[model samples]
Target: MADTAFEAQGESVEEVFRGATQALLESMANPVTVSGGWERAIERTDVDPSTLLFDWLSEVVYWKDAAGVVFREAPLTLTREGDVWLLRAGLIGAPVDQQTQELHADVKGVTKHRYELKQTGGSWKVIVVLDV
Candidate 1:
C-alpha cells in the first residue's frame, strides 16, 4: 500500500488542527505559490475530537478534488455543542497551476492505518496516514 504517515502537534486542539491543515496542504504542493484566491467554507461534526478531525481532513481532500483546486490556507475553529463537536474552516485555495506551483503526488484519501490523535501534558498531537 502506497501511503504516508503525518504528525502534527500544538499547545491546543485548535492549534493542532491548524498544524494538521498545514501538513495536508504541504503534502500536495508548495503552499507559498498557491495564492488562495478561492474560498470554501466547511462544517463537520462528530461525537469526539479524534473523529471530528478525521472527518474534517477528509472534507479538505474532498474540496481539493471536487473544486479542482489546491488549498493554500485553512483557518478553523472547533467547538462543542451538546453531544457533538463541530469544526468550521475557511479553506482558501487556487486552481492548480503547473507553471507557478511545485506539485507533488496526488493524495487518494485519509486512511485508518495507524491513525491516532492524543493529548498529553497539556499539548495535543495527531498522526494520520494518507493513501497517496
Candidate 2:
C-alpha cells in the first residue's frame, strides 16, 4: 500500500477543514450516493491548529469505522478560545448500502507523515496524508 495525500486551500480555517474532510470522505465513498440521514455531533480541542486538524480528522475516521456509515457533509465551526483550537461538527450521512452505494478505497487512518496546516497570504492551506 502507498500513502494517499490531498491538499485543501481556503480563505478560512473552517473552510479548509471542510474541504479536507470532503477529500477524505470522497476517497472512501461516493458522497452523492450516501443519504444525508444519519447524524453525529463531534467536539474536539487541541492546542495547535495542525494537531487539531489531525485529531479532528482522526476522530472523523473513528466515527466512520465505529458506526459503519459513510458521511456526506460535516457542518462545523472551528474557533479559538484562549489559545485552544475548538472544532464542533455536525456530521451527516447514512448507512452504506452496497446495493445502492459505491465504496472506494478504505481509509485505515489519518497519518502524521507529511501532514501540514499553514496560513499564507490570508488563506489557509492544508496537506493531509491518509493511510489507506
List RMSD in Å for every model shown.
Answer: 1.4, 1.3
TM-score winner: 2
**Cα displacement (Å) at residue 33, model 1:** 0.6
Give the lDDT of residue 94 in candidate 1.
Answer: 94
Candidate 1 local distance difference test against the native:
0.86
CA lDDT, candidate 2, residue 12: 92
Poorly placed runs, candidate 1 (over 4 Å): none
Off by over 4 Å in 2: none
lDDT of each: 0.86, 0.87
Most lDDT-accurate candidate: 2
